[model samples]
Target: MSADRGLWITLEGGDGTGKTTQAVLLAEWLRDGGREVLRTREPGGSEVGVLIRDIVLHHRGDVAPRAEALLYAADRAHHVATVVRPALERGDVVIQDRYLDSSVAYQGAGRILDPVEVRELSLWAAEGALPDLTVLLDLDPAEARCRLDSADKPFDRLEAEREEFHARVRDAFLGLAAAEPERFLVVDAAQDPESIASAVRERVAALLG
Candidate 1:
């Protein structure tokens, strides 16, 4: 990547972990600093991705583990190509929700597939593009469940999964962060939103510098 290339930041965590909230805060912060920002998400970042998102998140049918991985990979491929890369090329900071890490956590560990294989597939799909920074909102699964329950909204397929599955996903996320410490900023999601946002901003400011 060029030194002048715009930053690519991905926020990752299990459902109700406040990835969306942090993404928004980061985007607003970047914009306040006079930076161009592109906010996007996987499985729905592009037009093609919208259709795939429906199938993967709302089909209400059994999807084989490998098949599910492939669907996510497909969305990642198109999203990075048509949405993410162009924003970076234009020197716009891209704050994305759920990148390949989610697949490695959800499909790989949660569904009992090989995390390494899932990561390799995603790398191939995105032509080896990795985020400049990945913010992981670490939270207990039970706390996340309680938050989701309080929302009283419909659960997407992933959110509706059992607690054990979510536990696996959280562990996988922590493992990924440990393996790539330089690229990850893990925060306690149980913190007040302002505190979490402050931590994220501090790390992001360093990158911007």
Candidate 2:
């Protein structure tokens, strides 16, 4: 939380919202501007996180919802300790693909758990570390599903959930953005990637200035 620390930016949304693409673009743009940037993703940001990601996202059998939430929290704990926090403390802009908000939406709303509790668990796990700005790529669940289908990638555990689950996740993200407008920039992800990236750059420029 030091003022001298670099910005921590997170891109969040349901599956197929193009968070990965945006994260890459943002990091590249920042680096081109001469900022030291570290682009990472949750549930697989660190060495330990890779193992956790497999268990959480691709485990063959069913995982208890609470257990799933705790697993994500565990990954967050390790990821912040070993990767994210150090980078920020060293004054490197960190463009992360997901964060506690994903847990709040995927586990809390999508899994029918208490969103506040989910957020609290993640915060405590990561010692209350929060992104300076979270870019939420908001897209309709139906359209998102269509995009996922077109991608032809094997569906992960969370991505394979029903439409209703995805709908709830989308709603949860919007609700979080509404609650903290200053910390979140909600963009229409259905736009062309170039347009979306341009919008993201504008917000990030303001932050950097």
Candidate 3:
């Protein structure tokens, strides 16, 4: 937001809550309203980031919480440097599907890692950049799992965890929104996709104003 270019908005939620779809819809709406929007997602938004994503999410082998957190932070560092920062400098409003909050939620609270430690690592990864607005699409864990029906494509390594884990992550997201009341907007993801999109569009428009 300080770059004299565009605002940075991020969409965050548990698995299958439709963050990607809503992000796309909001970006399209912003563009139609005559703004340049750069749409992207985390874990694999860049070259090295993609490999890092696979390592973090697909490696079924033993993985320590600290080490796993480091991998995620590494991918995010690349993603912000290569994709997010440059786009913002060019006057493009960046609508990132997921960002730093995911790390704090999934690795920190969901994995039972210390929040202070997670914050420290995130500070290193992100340097000074942060989102202007973070829209958290809240959803029930059972509902989220039902949405991800399949053997062909599995949930992310973090997302594939137990329901209690996701519930903790969701609570963490809510706490984050409460802690930073000005930045995060909590939205119910239980509604239909179209209705959710409409709600997001309305919130995003308000944020930009």
Candidate 4:
């Protein structure tokens, strides 16, 4: 809430947890309130990030855990420098789909890497930028899998991971929220879209004030 900067909000959760749906609703609501909102996501928020995203998410070949982590950090470094920071400096609300927390959860906990080292690498990559508010949409891995099956979309690398991996990711996200209560809003993704959006809006409204 610095005088020269607008808010930074991020939506985070496992696949099929409706982060996109809620991001859309939140962006629309912010726009309706006469705010300039920039909707973006990690690993594809910049042109460089798009290439990294394809390799990390779509390549059929195996990526070593440390290599994957480095790729994410590369994307984050370029993305924050070229895309996210400018929007915030211009006083635009940045509603991002994912951020460093995703790296910590997926690469660290899910992939059995050191979470602290992963976080440190991420912080170093983005020059220590953190979202002003992070909305974590929590859901069970089994239920999330069902939703993904119903969507009929091809599984990406991470989504194709075993349920146990996703469960670890979920627990990691919750732990992060618990550690940073003021910066995080943990929502039940099983709720209806409207209900979830309402909860998000309530939190965002308080921040805007």
Candidate 5:
């Protein structure tokens, strides 16, 4: 929000909670409202990010928790510096699919690392760039798994993790939102996509005001 930069909004949730769907919807809605919006996602938001994303999310074998965290931090560093920051500087609203919170939730909670440490690592890696608003789509892990099953796509490395892992991730997201009420809009993802998008639009509109 410094220097009157364009608003940076991020979508976050457990797997299959419709983050991608909502990110697209939010970006579309913002554009309809006459804003130039840049839609992107973590771990693959830049030319360098694609490789990092594959390793962290699609690699065939186990990645040590610390190593995995480092990969994400590396991607985030490149992404925020090259893609997100520049877009915001140009006065383009950025609707991002994930941010440091994901690392805190997934790598920290899900991977059993200290959430605070993971958060600090990500913040340091990205030079402390944070979103103006983070929309957290809260969902039950069982419901999220069902939704993923219905999608019928091969699960990514993280998505293929046990239900317990996802539950931890979900809880971490909620905890993060609770701690930063002003920066996070906690939405019930069980609702229909249209309804969820409407709620997001309303919150973002208020922010814009």
Candidate 6:
């Protein structure tokens, strides 16, 4: 890492939690404050990651949970080496839409992968790296689902499953937040976007200090 290397902050949440929107805003907020910030998202951040994302998110058939997890991890490994770590080494504030915790929550707990197995693989995927702060926008699974209109893309093989699956993912995210209060913060995302953004700004500002 460079002498003036920066911190990594990530935004995480279920499908309807507005992570995509907020990540953009947060990066802009930091830039406006004169901070060097790089904003990106997972499943597709680099060239390699984009290839992996096509297979994972739009695959025709149902993929096994373990296979899905590995795919996500692979993309993450490339993403970290190519994008995240490099930006951090350059002292740029790296804020991503999702990171390691998403894998643990969506694949490990939501899909019922052996927790221990996933954790070990997560370490490898991340190469022992972690974000300094993870903001999880928590919302009820059903409420979140309702936010996605037909204007949105059709559900993927993973999303075609029962609502129970997403409920599990939500619970898993909450559990992760509970386990790491300092590193993870869960904000109620059922609220208005502005309200959620306000809370996100406040928390991020505090952490950057």
Q: Where does model 2 exceed 4 Å of error?
A: 1-5
lDDT of 6 by residue, 65-95 (tens): 8888899889988999999998988889988
Tens-digit lDDT track of model 3 for 1-209: 12246888999989888888888788778878888888887888888988887888888787899998998888888888889898888978998888888888988998889977887787788786889889899998888888886435766677678989999998988888899988888889998888888877776777666
On lDDT, the stronger of 2 and 5 is: 2
Candidate 4's TM-score:
0.97
In angstroms, how far off is 156's CA in candidate 2?
A: 0.4
| Model 5 stretches astray by more than 4 angstroms | 1-5
* lDDT tens per residue, model 2, 1-209: 12355999999999999998998888888878888989899999999999999999999999999999999999999999999988988999999999999999999999999999999999999999999999999999999999999998999999999999999999999999999999999999999999999999999988888
Q: lDDT, candidate 6, residue 33?
A: 81
Q: For candidate 2, which ten residues in a row score worst on lDDT?
A: 1-10
lDDT of 4 at 20: 90
Candidate 4 displacement at residue 180 in angstroms: 0.7
| Full-model lDDT for every candidate | 0.94, 0.93, 0.84, 0.94, 0.92, 0.84
Clashing pairs in 3: none
Candidate 1's TM-score: 0.97
Q: Give candidate 5's error at residue 113 in angstroms.
A: 0.5
- TM-score each candidate: 0.97, 0.97, 0.92, 0.97, 0.97, 0.93
Please report how far candidate 3 places residue 146 from its true position, in Å. Answer: 1.0
lDDT of 5 by residue, 20-70 (tens): 999889888887878888999998999899999989989898899999999
lDDT of 1 by residue, 107-188 (tens): 9999999999999999999999999999999999999999999999999999999999999999999999999999999999
Itemize residue pairs with steric clashes in candidate 5.
none
lDDT of 4 by residue, 1-209 (tens): 22345999999999999999999999999888888999999889999999999999999999999999999999999999998999998999999999999999999999999999999999999999999999999999999999999999899999999989999999999999999999999999999999999999999988888
